[model samples]
Target: MNDKRASHGFRLTLAMLACVGAATLAGCNGGGDAHAQGRKGGEATAWGLPYFNMPDIVPPNVRQDAYTPLTDAQAGPPIDPIKGYRTEDLGGGVYMVGDGIYNTMFVVSDAGVILVDAPPSMGEKTLNAIQQVAPGSKIVALIYSHAHIDHIGFAAGVVKAFPGIPIYAHEETRKALAQANDPNRPVPTNTFNTLDVDFPVVVGNQKLVLRYPGPNHDPGNIGIYHPGQKVLMLVDVVYPGWMMWRRLGLATNIPGYFGLVKSMNARWDFDKLIAGHFQPGTKADVETQLEFMTDMHNALTEAISTIPYSDGRLNAADTKNSWAATRDWTDRLTNHCVNKVTPKWSTRLASFDVWIYEQCMALEQSIRIDGPSLR
Candidate 1:
């Protein structure tokens, strides 16, 4: 990795050059010119990468309405992001629980209410969200889509908030949590202890909530849908293009994503989608995500099966310019400027990422048959 301080790559260099190349060259001679330079400098401060492949890949987050990224003058794991919370009214005692950058939600009643994603930092915040949403109402159940830290980051929080609040997680989730607290924890808290709640599976006006796992983001990953309300909630399974959500281009599990889409499309009975992060979403986005997943899978499968590599390095002619190039050169470490930017997610997701990358390298080999493209 580059040893330069702050944002790495020439993108920042481009930004700085655009900021005052003219004024600096004009010399620091006069006050008026210097004042003009000041104005130019002020205009230079803007968020986001100045140069990315797609400007519209994800919607840009506005300052006032989105999670503001904190700058790190130092380097470590990618923990620059700190999640905060807010709520969006979704009518009928329902809401979109927003963590500034991502979104979570709840539906409440006197008996109990269902929650999407655990509150961050144990129950201090989850309990706080509960109190804010339906003060005094019991959190009858908690649902986790996957084991990503941001998704169930506060499972402990829920446990603390409501004590034995019945939490419903995918079967695999049960395993992850059961061993989450080991002293020699593997890959952080990838596993955890769920509330051991039983739930009913239903679709389309069916009151029964269901659990299904196909591709395995975290063994316990599944989607939550309310038949009557047509509310479908998923976490890492889908992320919206927004300021808070990171681009999954090179970070996601393409093959696992494909299986995930296939699984979701084959089953489930809802129309609205409340993804874990980015802008509020719809079922169409899920479908689109499916398509992308499939594309990635097909691309990777071909590469892996056909590409020829030796000594652990792919043959140059077979993978001239493709995802293989990136994977081959990916930094062995994802040192964040702060804490590990990624949360203590299920080992399943990690497994998926690994699978996807291996296949991606294969896909790179497949594309090599066509010769290198402008990477």
Candidate 2:
């Protein structure tokens, strides 16, 4: 037999011996339940072997019995069931509308209304909110944050409501929408390039400075800033009090995501942040999220450096298969990273347990493949 086959056979024999020995011990001890014993003993596995305290919420394999409860801060204000959506006036004529889950914004001016994003979840309620707040004003322009379907799915409805209304977005967004060929999100009528300088979209009496800070959550996801209102609307990048959606809000570029968050926190002169989810955020929320992200980065960096590839967890036969070996190594690294962060962050961020594993897995891969640059 070949060396690999021999090694596999030897390891299988050892595993069988270990199992027999374990059974012998149980039988000698009046056939005690190993799983029950494991629970009574500190840091024990199901078979009564000592192990780390694994998190209750593991993903892709382990289904959580119940997710961590949301704190009052994370829940934000309740939406009115009758109206199906709630609108918040953020000073000036800018108002935010959401169905307690998805959010979008609009700026009303003497000339007309400049609406930003049209989440399908909000649907026609977006128009209702605009009518309730702006009253009699026409929607002259619709600005898309990016080409994501969830954020701009209701653009079709907006177009139907106001025909021939000019739609504006970054040049990249237009390209993506055109490629998507999604009728729900008609290609922007007007597109601005965000190469070196910030693009300003002036409609009616309102003006929004659209700056594409490279790719973060998605390519061409621009920051919609209202200088007059001191409100900055950047969607899918920051999650305020809650944990970010899976894979860092499914960011296309991990390094860019990090850099954008740091840049926005440092450069943007805004009091309120409309992060396109839940309620608007403040500088404190941004700082808190930054701190959490930094912790995750540091923990993952240490884990990658300390954890060995040959951790003895993989079967001997699997070593010949590179894909299997890599999967085992990454799983071990991710679990270590998850355990390190859970202690401090579990209660700090809402739904932290829900997506922490995915976040760790994403960062680990980025660190290995994309180079470690959490600017």
Candidate 3:
């Protein structure tokens, strides 16, 4: 039964494809009200792909063209860190770090500095970004929110910097890392096991809480919470206050993803969110994520409710075409999101979100039902 593949692939953006971006798009310092839509004012289309018309509330400097597959950068199009990694000091030497897509929250505690996911791509400049905050504190702990490469790719950098620092991850996560690290495997550079920590062993730290969000983004995915700062570091499972100029909705398997969101929400919560990517967010993002999940849930419920497609229409879920609920969720995008950026971006968000979701769906179908434990 594990061979369930959706009828078609939905579009996605490079920004919305991972645990960090869509997962953490909810909470921002600005008014935290979940908008019914974004502020994109215009609409455009290209490549026979219908461009989504949006409201007039786009973010700054977003490219409006649909991001077709780029063969150049493996990480999609590269974002400028210097201009974007605008670190905000929350006093006490603690910093909520990121440029919008990949933000890390660093806690300079009495013991040492704890980093929630290193910069996805780190060189001397990335390391320098952290050092500027605390000149000589060892990266005492490296906590990964999920096994996705964007969240853990910089582990090598952190390892090079801290050497034997206590790297933490879900037990399952460590196993995924080993597989990803083997050169023989495809996508060997996946930052699957960058930080190795046992969730049961350190679930409740006096300073921070570590959690295992099973089978949500990945089976080994875990979340790190800093109770003191009210910073919840989890991604992919939930996204908050996301700008849709990217039209990022990479839901691979609707039925399965619905189950995942419910399971993770059963895990943890926080006041301030350090998502895998995008702005530091709030509880509202979790709720928005729930909405998406609920919608998908209902979609599946309707699709499965009716067995024969020729039978009278059952619901969004009843027909074998029930998977359309996944794209239906995206089509309901707030127009303001796509139009919020520069002109000619009607396809940008839809192109990215739709495609990424397709890839995830395709991958989900390829895996075995009783799949190997990432651990």
Candidate 4:
């Protein structure tokens, strides 16, 4: 018994020594000469892969002093610091109100004002804007561009201001609000289910046409257009001068998003576009966004087909770990796609450096799943 116990202890000691030796060689805790330390103190595990030059815009997981500055065109008219919002006239009775970040529209009619989207960011300021332009004009109706909290979270405030005012939304928006059951966003009083035809809401002299182009940014996100003013308002889809919010504005359906942007101009004949963010846009802005989307799609598709799954970058020991291997493959693929578009796009779109990697990753995954079938 003593001999057997001694032999077991000796083997355990040898095993521990082997582990310590391996760790020392690998620089302890999977780091060392085998890792690249970022400027911000984050370390990227070495994959023995060719170095991918990061875009001037900071990549994720790294702290930076500041982001790329916005171009002059990207910056819109300044907002009043005290009021915390800005209002722009869209001609005729239609006017746009925004905090320079979140925007909504209101149309003043002979009967009353028709308020479109009450983003919580602008909250009471939305009502104040309506009052500023058309004093004593009761907000007769409220329209939700979509069911997103950022866009319509302040609907209840509007309803409170004008008791029993009809709230209009697509059936999907109503359903979503009903599910949420939040007091901030009241369920629509009137809901439209038509997908093909335009749903027009005429209040006194003002008329706003609502059209649902299927699901893009979110389900039931409809286009609100004023034919007389030649203005179109669509929420959370186009970013005007900026690169889209991360993962294509956190789109639930990427293919649908691509389709909507591609066909937006052809479908709506509008001089000014109220895209629910930043400054109002023009047909030229839509065209620029479409070009960016197309480049992203084309670049991702090419990377998906040409970049090998293994690519000789991943460590041999990690081969059996499917998740690790997949992660490495995707990182390489995203980097390749980012590098392809950085030259032209980095200078063109605002925050192009900020969300480009995420955009590439999103598109690459979409092409793999919701694909044109990888060639």
- Model 2, residue pairs in steric clash: none
Give the per-residue lDDT of model 4 (tens digit) for 1-375: 698766655543443343334433433223333333221122222113223333333446544456679977788888899988898998899999999888989999999999999998889999988889988889999999999999998889999999999999999998999999999999999999988479999999889999999888899999999999999999889998989999989888888888888888999999999999999998898899888878877877777788778855467889999998888788777877787888888888888878898998888888888984223
Candidate 3 to native Cα RMSD, angstroms = 14.0
RMSD of each: 13.8, 8.0, 14.0, 9.4
Better of 1 and 2 by TM-score: 2
The residue-by-residue lDDT of candidate 1 on 1-375, one tens digit each, is 656533443444443444324423432222344344434655323332121111111112211122223333111123223434556676656677665445677777546777767635433555666677777766666666665665667666565656665556665665665667522111222223333232563212224364554444455666666656667676666644321123332223434444565556446666566766544666666665555444544444443444333223344564766665554433111111001211221121222222333333433433344332212
Off by over 4 Å in 1: 1-84, 119-123, 182-208, 242-256, 294-375
Where does the lowest 10-residue lDDT sum fall in candidate 4?
38-47
Q: Please provide, for model 3 over 1-375, each residue's C-alpha lDDT reduced to its tens digit, 9 standing for 90 to 100.
A: 232222121112222232123332331111222121122211111111221232222222332344444233223334564554557676555577665556677777556677766655443444566677877766677676655676667776777767666666665666776667732111222233323332431222336667663454566566776655656676665555442212123433333344555544444545676666666667766666555434323333333343222322124343456565433333222222222222433232223333333322222332323231121
Comparing candidate 3 with candidate 4, which one achieves the higher TM-score? Answer: 4
The count of backbone overlaps in candidate 4 is 0
> Could you tell me the TM-score of candidate 2?
0.86
Instruction: Give the C-alpha lDDT of model 4.
Output: 0.81
